[model samples]
Target: MLDVLAGHAARVRAADPLAGGQDRLPKPGLGEQLVEVPGAVGLASMDRSGLDTLNATWGPLVVHRLHARVGGPDPEAALGALLDAWTAAPRREPGPLAVLWPSRDTAAVRALAVRGFAPTVTVAARPRRPPAGQATDPRVRPATADDLDGIARLYEALVAYDAQFGWVTPRPSTPARIREHLTGTLPRSWAWVAEHDGTVTGVVIVDPPPRSRWIASMVTRMPAAYLGVMYADPAVRGRGVGAALAAAAHARLDAWGVATTLLHHAVANPLSGPFWARQGYRPVHTQWVRQGRPSAR
Candidate 1:
């Protein structure tokens, strides 16, 4: 397994230097499957069940994830074999099957495409850059516990907008959960809100490196930070509120000497793609998913 992973890592490095060697996988649980595709690179299936609240708020209710070590003479065939084995097996549970592949690995994308997968989200990264060109936007200020109501409101707007893109959804508990989370982290995490005429119009939340360990492995850079949440009200779209909030977040991350600032955005979000691009983030890992009929399981 180590040898196979090493070979795959080498190929990924050649394809995109920005994508670091992140091929290791955790031990699979009871329902997971380790596929055997003879002469194929490697395949490990994951069951992202058992955590209902976490999964529903962040992703599909039940997700079947894949770790495909594709990078050989014929990566497509290898990935195809993994998919064939996966499909032939009876599915006891369902949601969407996701495979996170390097954005630059165009060769492996074919296997996923033919199997009904579409790239829905991208984990983007930006290296350390100079601090904000000017003073922090006067309209953007550090969030306080007092701003919970406003921050939560903008968060709901964000979820509602992103839900239409088919990746995120809101549950009955989502609002309370979000409120609870923000209540706990507002004072500790790097959070900011944009105020237009005294009404909060935008919100930005980035997890400090210490709090970003959950996603740090996705990138090779050290001392990484994760931009967990960001939303701008539709009423204030054309204005620079969103940009101001983002600039504030970037300035904070830069001051911390972060090597990489990472965030995930839905591929279907027409606005997010261009917005994050302008913010200097690019796709390092593209999360491709195959769904059943409608959106969720």
Candidate 2:
């Protein structure tokens, strides 16, 4: 199993150098199953009740998670067999059953697409670069406690805007949950905001390497930072507000000597794909999801 996964990692890293060779495969815990196919192995893990225990903003929670060691010639068959074995049983929840695969590994798409999964989100990454000149707009500035409400409103708008894409759902508790999260992380987190005529119209937040350790293993780079939240008012769209906010964040990240910066965006978001691409971020991993019908068959 370890050898299979290592081979899979090598193939993936060859396609995308930013992909971390998952050298450390921890022992499967309770509710995790190891399933096999012709030339691959898959570990189907359950996160039963996991989402309910986490911050509400950390959602679009998937209960059934499938990880596969599939680098064989028939990548689609390997993955399709694994999915069949994993979803053989009826699920207890209506949440999605998901598989996160390397972005450049297009061979596995047939398996996922045939199984009803859709590429919903991307875990994008970009390596450190020299300072981007200066923020395009001078109105961008660091965030403070007094700016929390404005930030929260912008975040809610972001969620609402994204929910239309069918991946990120807007929950009633999302507003309060985001505010509560920001209240705690804002003091220590690196954040900035854009003001338009004295009203906060945009916000960006990041967790430095120390605070972003929860997801550190996702990449091979050292001292990675997570761009946790970023949103700008609709009125400020097409202005340089978003670009300026990103510039402020990247300048600080480069100064910190961070190796990689990571964030997730909906794959179907017309605005997101182009915006982040312009910022030099490319897809490292994509999360494909089969939603709603997990409980049906």
Candidate 3:
């Protein structure tokens, strides 16, 4: 099984240089279980047992990674067999299951969809180098303690906007949570804001990837910076505020010597897909989701 996964990873990376190699499988911790099929594998955590407990949070997730050998005779049959094995495996608990695969692996994707998996999120990446002729607006600067309120407001606006588009569900205390998150992250992460006429119009937060047991060993060969959150005031949209903020953030990451920066955007987000594309980010991994019971038949 490990050899099969390793071979699949190699082929995926070869098909798309951005799809980085997959070296580490999800190791089961306490109360967790790891399951493997012919061309697919999954790690299931028992923290979530019901639909209500299944949200977008990372903990208590059932994550599956699948790959199919392209150009092989009866590739669909091979994938269907793997999917059957995976779905038939016993689960310690019931919760939302997420399956992720390379966007270029259309065979596996089609099989998953036939089994009821739907596209949820797309993780994209681009070189940290800023494009040529990039100009930083003098008004853009590193965030300060005094800028928390403005940043929080922008974040609140972002959450609300995302909610409107059904991309996220905003909680009642989302504003306060945003404020607290910004307060805690300011000192440790690189955050910047764009100002115009003495008001912040855009914000971008970048951070180095933290050590994690879940990340694949092969994927970590190249260090990456993460674009945690980037939000611009709707009123300031189309005025170059977002571009300026992104350029500044990229310049800083490049100077830090990171090889690449990664971020995920909802494929359904009309605003985000094109905006990030304009920033040179392309999809590497596509996260497909099944909201309810497993549909493996």
lDDT winner among the candidates?
Answer: 1
User: How do the residues 41-156 of candidate 3 rate in per-residue lDDT, one tens digit apiece?
Assistant: 55544333222331322222334333333223344555666666656767654644566677765655677788887887787777656345566788689899999998888877
lDDT of 2: 0.79
Better of 1 and 3 by TM-score: 1
RMSD of each: 1.9, 2.4, 4.6
lDDT per residue (tens digit) for residues 122-153 in model 2 = 99997999875763567999999999888888
Ranking by TM-score: 1, 2, 3
Q: Each model's TM-score?
A: 0.93, 0.92, 0.80
Candidate 1 regions exceeding 4 Å error are 1-3, 41-43, 48-54
Tens digits of per-residue lDDT for model 1, 1-297: 566576678778888877864565556667566775753443456555333363576676777777777546777787788777776777666677788889987776788899889999999998999775678778899998888999999888888888887877777778888888888887779999988888898999999999988888877887999998999988889788888888898988888899999999999999999999998899999999988656454
Q: What is the lDDT of residue 152 in candidate 1?
A: 92
All models: lDDT? Answer: 0.80, 0.79, 0.65
Best-to-worst lDDT order: 1, 2, 3
Best-matching candidate per TM-score: 1
lDDT of 1 at 281: 94
